[model samples]
Target: MRPMPHDHSDHPHALLPPDPALRVKALETILTRKGLIDPAALDELIDTYENRIGPKNGARVVARAWADPMFRAALLEDATRVVADLGFYGRQGEHMVVVENTPQQHNMVVCTLCSCYPWPLLGIPPGWYKSDAYRARAVREPRKVLADFGVTLPEGTSVRVWDSTAEVRYLVLPMRPEGTDGLSEDALADLVTRDSMIGTDIPKVPS
Candidate 1:
């Protein structure tokens, strides 16, 4: 008879009482048998969370910052207070840092060691961002990785790569899009995409 595939029974954590045993076991079974999480289902879950409570809430913060120069200064100086000022507080986001992208200096964020991200402000990261390829390559070769993402930096421009660590998180402040001179706060918030928040894309004025 063919030998049964080696079991993972010897794993130390296998038999240990999970904090939430039933849910943990169900997730493990799905991952083990299927070898992948269902992207569509994950997207649905993300959509539900976003609609219920996600960056759209944070978009209002960005809109307010864009409209108010003093608030923008406060946000750049101390993100936690600015976010708190707008009533968008969380355990993780309580110590936030906002990085502004200017004509001369551009900033991109990544987590080299792990997937440390500001979930309270930007919601769940996209699949590409959490992938090993992106995590490794982004820190090792930031400009090249950004180029692949269709974000070409100007010649002689310096690219700063920030690695998000414990106790500190970052959010990118994309430049104000053109033709938004007199737009309402809600309208501006509608244009603030997650990509803009991550420095992968600039917000665009709706046509």
Candidate 2:
């Protein structure tokens, strides 16, 4: 729907960062000069993603699934329909797939072809996600990538790398952490991070 999401790494003006902050400012200036966007409105939209409409939405879905076995079953069975029903489908997120990370298996996602991602569910993709280094290394060395993310699994644990395309995007369903037995849905949601849903990390147990 959004012009077949692909890597713009080759674009001369593509935003890659040694200084993402400055790049953002320059892009904003150009767009403003072109009168394509209102700075005030743009700031508001950025604020929405930063504060309100971020991974919090996906966290709610994860939290609900953790608390309700029925919902979890339905989510795993039909991620596209179930997530759309929950109002998390848009653009690159039109085709949703939920891959669960089990005690014996871990799932991580990469867009080897391009940076296709579930933006509606995960909000903005992290800068590292779009880097050529990440897109390339994630598939070739997922365990190493996970370790860089501070996740070291047991030797017996198998890692699965899923590649996203223009047709489909994936969300990793991380296992609920231990010691969350008595926590409410909201409490559990707080423990879910964007990295956890991407399979690079697991939900943290609050101390």
Candidate 3:
């Protein structure tokens, strides 16, 4: 009797999925073939996101937190609920927690298991954020990673790393920037960067 066709589903190689970039490339190829998208249009789309969505949204959240103590308290206590209160809550961010950074303590976040993140408030995770290099090195060498990101903690400040898992997501509520005292919430939000929301960068001073 002839052997049945081999089954590969249980194989170790089969257990690993293809890279997401491959899927994106396949989709782009299909779109190009169908004449639905041109190369220039695709480049423009990428630029739109690079300039607009992620960092800009994060800056808005930070600015609001700085101007309103009550809102800040709500954000720290329950990030998802508070963010939803501002109309930013959505699919991936049904559960969220905001960690506060202080003079004595600094917080950094990572998804050691997977790239689980609060997407609604922060938008898409940057390319580097989802890389194995970042995930492996973040927990293993947090201070060095923060330094590379241009964030320097004080000599005595304690570093706290929050590892986001599938069940819960996290955001970092950075301390309010100086020179932003009299800025309105709308004006302040523009200074917030996605990095600050993730604890990698701090808000820039208003010029």
Candidate 4:
């Protein structure tokens, strides 16, 4: 997917960076011309993965973990198998790890080299998540990066950043919110935001 417009504030006199979409389109055109892939079929596949198979799959997983102690233990012990057993397995998400967020420690995921992520669960990664700024700063200065996302953690809370690679990706299991003991699995799923699963933000508390 094409990323949003980039900032050129640091180099006001320099030309803006090349639009990544232009390069992607050029490659797609060349591939289509070479009969490497049909544009229509390619678009269809992308649409299905991006739209049809969305973050709700992950929401369900998070919700189940929240409502079931056994499942949560299984998830924390072996996330790959737990998710696969629940039919959330796929190419980029074949290897997965779950990190728990606690009162004293917060966990966040980043891809230092590339936008490697759990696609089958989280679906498409957000533009900011794939930005150069996030890839660099999330590791260097996590609290500042999180603050930009409007997530202010307590000073005592230690932020642990996990770098995702092609071999394995991570999902953050945000601590369950209070007053949620009565919620159903689907209701709990509603509270599970994509950013929460990524550890940039916490789950939306039920009112």
Name the best candidate (by TM-score): 4
> How does candidate 1 score on lDDT?
0.78
For model 1, the stretches where C-alpha displacement exceeds 4 angstroms are: 1-9, 13-50
TM-score attained by model 4:
0.85
TM-score order of candidates, top first = 4, 2, 3, 1
Better of 1 and 4 by lDDT: 4
The Cα error of candidate 3 at residue 159, in Å, is 0.8
Please provide, for model 4 over 38-66, each residue's C-alpha lDDT reduced to its tens digit, 9 standing for 90 to 100. Answer: 98998899897878776898899999998
Q: State which candidate has the highest lDDT.
A: 4
Candidate 2 positional error at 142, Å: 0.7
Cα RMSD to native, each candidate?
8.6, 5.3, 6.1, 7.3
Clashing pairs for model 3 are 59-192
* Candidate 4 or 1, higher TM-score: 4
Residue-level lDDT of model 3, residues 51-158, one tens digit each, is 644556656777788888988888888777777877776656788888888999888888988888777677779877898988998888888998888888889988
The 10 consecutive residues of candidate 3 with the worst lDDT sum are: 8-17
Name the runs in model 4 displaced over 4 angstroms: 1-26
lDDT of 1 by residue, 1-207 (tens): 997787666965666456777756677566767867665677777685667556676678788888999989999999988787777667467689999888887778888787877777776677877889888887778888877777887777677778886769888887788889989889999999877777766776779
Residue 81 local lDDT, model 1: 81
TM-score of each model, paired residue for residue: 0.76, 0.80, 0.76, 0.85
